[model samples]
Target: MARESFKIFYAGRNDVILYEGVEEVLESLKQKYVLGVITNGNADTKKIGIDHYFDFNISASDINAGKPEPIIFEEALRQSGFRAEEICHVGDHPVNDVEGSSDFGMKSIWFNEKELDWPLDQKPNFKEVNSWSELERTVESF
Candidate 1:
């Protein structure tokens, strides 16, 4: 019963707030590149008020699988009609976002919002950003 209740509560959570300047950066990026979201959690963009900005969204619920697995990344590739080299995935997670995308052949940007150190055993072989401004600059350069 507890597990079922937890599931129900989690499924109802769709209010994901964006960080400062995210909307502006996302809008800017949309003008230049195709933007999509690959999330491991429940993120209803419509409720968050950013649905119009993305080309598509792939969530764990949609695929029945999560990141660090290639299936989700492959699905994004299929839907966007872009080759692995043409796409870049940006996220905060060390393994799920950085290593996962890198292993699958897509470029990755590690958004270390909290200034956390990389895991001791896993050196990031990718770009890292501390803020959305940094990310915007990086993405614009590509």
Candidate 2:
């Protein structure tokens, strides 16, 4: 009963809250590049009402691997049909998103909305953006 109830409640992802400027940023970026989502969570862009902006959505659950793992990144590269160096991954996690994509040979942009200092010992090979407004510029600079 609990499992079913949970599934029912989460069916539409109605509780998913996007940060400010998410739509605007997505709209802007969509105009210039091929947009896709690579997520470890069950965020359905369609359910979240943003599916039209993305060309594809790759989920960790679908492939039995998560970020920081090469498999997930590999899957994204395969789906994108773009060379690793030609792609740029934007995410908030210092290790999983930033380091993972960078190590996979893709350009990375750290969405540091909280302005937190980087927690890793190694210097970041990725660029950092604190606001959605900064995102497009950062990605373009890559």
Candidate 3:
């Protein structure tokens, strides 16, 4: 469904972790700075008109590596032509989103909208926000 020309997809492979505000957050960031998405799925970036908003995307389905592995993030930063330090990666996964972003010195902010308890083994040093408004404020202050 994603590979065909002119086809658009909203989500893929049941990746429920990416919820509503992702697009909103990205749109807000796009107004202040460059934004993008990097993942291990085949979800079409253009389905919701985010393809132009983001400069690039690195997906595990297109590469040999995935999240929690710094290479994928590295590839994303490289493809976007933006240094990792200049961007912040946000997501619901504790290990992949928080740890992976921090491992390479890129900023990380966990989207804790689900109210799950923080992981003991995976405590993050980066910012954590539960709502998109809070996330906007947090990012602005950074």
Candidate 4:
């Protein structure tokens, strides 16, 4: 069936490339914070070899809800059993990741690796980091 074929292709994920220093950052952060991943994409941390670092991974497909939707964040809150204020979400997408998390009352960090401008008109209070090292420091400061 077509669905089964798609699953095979998706599971292969031959093109999944990690950014530099990702493992280092994840390793360091895992030592301190209760790390979780909330993603709209199908990037399996287990397949990517980073599963041990996170407490849980929430994907849009899992809940039938995508980012910028409160339900997705609500699910994260439910799974993590943490108050929104107690969590700091670090993501690259301005709207989906940063705004979505911020609007849901979680602190957000913009992973601006591309050096792009803040695209939104009303800038919410969020930190921006261009590198994994900077991200770690920012999270620690939270």
* RMSD (Å) per prediction: 2.1, 1.7, 4.7, 1.9
* Residue 135 Cα positional deviation in candidate 4, in Å, after optimal superposition: 0.7
Clashing residue pairs found in predicted model 1: none
- State the lDDT of candidate 3 residue by residue for 33-117, as single tens digits: 7666788767766654568777777778788999989888888777878888887888878888888888888888998888888
Each prediction's Cα lDDT score?
0.88, 0.89, 0.77, 0.91
Query: Candidate order by lDDT, highest to lowest?
Result: 4, 2, 1, 3
**CA lDDT of 35 in candidate 4?**
93
Give the lDDT of residue 48 in candidate 3: 44
TM-score of each: 0.89, 0.92, 0.78, 0.91
Clashing pairs in 4: none
Q: Which candidate is the best by lDDT?
A: 4
lDDT per residue as tens, model 2, 1-142: 9999889877855557888988999999999998889988886788788999998899899999999899999988888899899999999999899999999999999999899998989966889999998998889997
TM-score ranking, high to low: 2, 4, 1, 3
**Model 4, 27-111: lDDT tens per residue?**
9999988999898988688888788999999989999999989999998899999999999999999999999999999999999
Give lDDT for model 3: 0.77
What lDDT does candidate 4 reach at residue 38? 92
Model 2 segments beyond 4 Å from truth?
8-14
Which stretches of model 1 miss by more than 4 angstroms? Answer: 1-12
